[model samples]
Target: MEFREDILGAPYEAAELTLRPDDEGAVCATLVRRLVPGSERAVLYVHGYNDYFFQTNLADHYTALGFSFYALDLRKYGRSLRPHQSPNFVRHLAEYDEEIDEAVRIIRELDGHRQLLLNGHSTGGLIAALWAGRRAGRAVVDGLFLNSPFLSMPAGPAVRTVGGPAVTAIGRMAPTRVLPSSLNPHYTHSLHKDHQGEWDFDLTLKPAEGFPLYAGWLAAIHQGHRRLRSGLGIDVPVLLMASTRSISTTVWNEGLRRADAVLRADDIAAQGPRLGRHVTIVRIEDGIHDLVLSGEAARTRVFAELDHWLAAYLDVPAIEAPLIDAPLIDARPADARPAGESA
Candidate 1:
């Protein structure tokens, strides 16, 4: 249900963040913003590939937490796309730093919120994590919330290891070359269009025929993945959420109802610690690829876990800083034990 209160009641205004052509003469990134009237905390959400900010409810969730939400539809994705540029194509993930930096500057100036949180989903999740790592000790972010982040190559090792290089090379050479993909009618059919699915985002804008996978995009992703796997010294606390099981992008099945079908849950569990300081990995039972967007029962379970984490982290009183400036750990640094213990 829509909150009865007037959202972003005052002074808050929606604005656009624009960048001009670099030496390449290609204008890039138009960051979008909708500031809260009088809210203090701000959240910047980055969406996954083939995704945009249609989940208005998620924005509401953050508003309820007293955070004004702003979502970025990256270059060549969603509202940021122009006629000339290709959709969802990039050679280096670092190239996105410009857009992200622009967004941050806008949020800080407009809302002036001390507590800034970064939330991302799927590929967006990876982007946010990498951004946070880059900003470590820079006093840029308060915490990070990654929901079912796509950290590793979703495709199996064989294709990903071999095909990835090929895709990157091809993308760089001829980014316009169309790749083959077949839609799974089952998954598409099940999504509630008006209510349950509750979205009619333009396929043209976010095409069912996803944009090409040029070498630039593939190479950038490989580079980003490598950085994530190497580990970042994120100074802030983090929460990583995922489904209890892995569901394939393969055709729909009753099993799809209960698993993350997109990302391997084990990957999330294994890499949770690699993210940063004091990380918590919560697995929601029966959750789908996007837990918050999951079907009925799983959705409830997903929110339940979210509540538990928030209560423990955000809701409770802040712990007083210890007299001595030191960190306590059950394990030593550079020491990664088995999954269960580390997580």
Candidate 2:
């Protein structure tokens, strides 16, 4: 494994891991690392669907808390995307086990880090939880941190119960067939600096329209959700963080800037406890789907809560507070809304 400067540039580096080719062609995974010499603890992060490791501030936060940070761009996603491969396509969620296994091996055996934390966001959270459950007796993971894990279908029960089986059945016959998608561009708009948010990233990598949703991929996600619901039995301590509220909308609205426009926070909170016996759920008021990328105040609250949990559970020191550069546009008064509208 050779390390090179990451796409994000200085102080960040990535190592590529070539894996067996799938039907699509050659595929690989990239492990992005930010290390401080002599740090005994490390955190391995996994990104969600249509996402990559562009949150440098998150790495800085973990570094401040005395932990080395690493993120995995799973095969066909982000840095691992090959020209011949379909973006983010996989027939089984377990297909990721190879990459996760390699990442853990490098962190534990090669890097010599004694305590390792598994951090995952959205779909990544579901993947990590399932892996931890599978590896419970092995004692490889010290703890688990989930950011708005996709516990269930965002659609209500009717769709999940009725449409889920139909989707899976079609997926079995034609795994690569694209399915109709309803993802709104508003969430992407809320996170990009060019649109309405503070951070900037490659729109091509995580486009507003997003990559096509394939039947097989959706089926894999459904299977993972089923496994999670049945009980993961993950022995490690788990911290699940999410926005306090979820607002569904097809049109642009100020509420989309403050609340989670992606997954329902209630679904996450409800299913969080089932992941393990020792699961702690924290809801951040006015935070977005990705808590780390929320507005200044909410983001700060997320870090503070995470720091507190780490201190209590892992005996880690408190993180020295840093001045936030992003403006808290979402921290407006409760009654605040665009003008000319009457409630």
Candidate 3:
């Protein structure tokens, strides 16, 4: 493992974990850490599809609450992407277990953190939930937090029930085949400072058009969703959050600035309970798919709810400032939106 300054630069460190490859050549995973010296509690975050660990505001929020924060950019993603590997491609969702295992080992044994929290967004959320369930008796994680977890196909019931099997079959026959996707580029536009929002990140890693959705990858995701639907039985307290509403549109609209333009919020809320018995769900009004990256007002609410849940269920102490008020480490000019609107 080699530590280096992250893309956000200064104070933040990213550790590269090299892993053995399976027919795909060399691969690696990056552990982005905000080291709070002597901190016993830590949160290991996982990013969603076509995303990475550029959310320094999230790390600051956790650090302020006295917990060290670490985010894993899984193999073929962000800092881990290799020139020889397919970007964000995986034959099985379980393939990520190797990286997650190594990350948790480093955090628990190497770093000596006793209490570890697992936080995941979108596809990462599904991966984390499944891993926790698989490790149920091992007590690897103390709690789980999911932001807009992709529990089911956003296409609705027919796709999940019928089209799912067909996709899986195609995946087995030709795993590398690209699948048709209807992702709207406007959602990306709404999040970047260069476009319509406040955050600045590498468009190459998380492009506005997004990486191709391969048949194998889609099949793997549906399989994970099936496992989640059957119930995970994750033996830890779980906090699930999503936007109060979902707006699916191909064209840009003001609603894209507030509501989730990715996964269906209702789907997230409905399937959250299947993760465990101690699951609590919160719906943030006017929030985006990634709650932490939502507008200031929405993020404030998200942090408040998170703090309350952590205090009550995980026995985490309350911090004076539940949310970070300072500007993001990588400060960028805030793009003006309509009055009362926030991204």
| Residue pairs whose backbone atoms clash in candidate 2 | none
User: Which parts of model 3 are misplaced by more than 4 Å?
Assistant: 321-343
lDDT of 1 by residue, 3-30 (tens): 1222233322334456655433465554
- The whole-model lDDT of each prediction reads 0.68, 0.88, 0.87
Please, what are the lDDT tens digits per residue for candidate 3 over residues 1-343?
7778887787888888988876689888999888899899999999999898888888888998889899999999988998888789998888899999999999999999999999999999999999999999898999999988888788768767999999999988998898877778999999999999899889998999998888989889879988888899998999999887889888889898899899888777878779999998877877899899898898998998899888988788986665544332211112323565543
Of 1 and 3, the candidate ranking higher by lDDT: 3
Stretches of candidate 2 above 4 Å error? Answer: 320-343
What is the number of residue pairs that collide in model 1?
Answer: 6
What candidate 1 gets wrong by more than 4 Å, as runs, is 1-14, 20-25, 28-34, 163-178, 181-189, 192-198, 249-252, 314-343
Clashes of each: 6, 0, 1
- Residues 158-242, candidate 2: write the lDDT tens digits: 9999988888898899999999987889899989999987889999999988999999999999989889889999998999998
List RMSD in Å for every model shown: 7.2, 5.6, 7.1
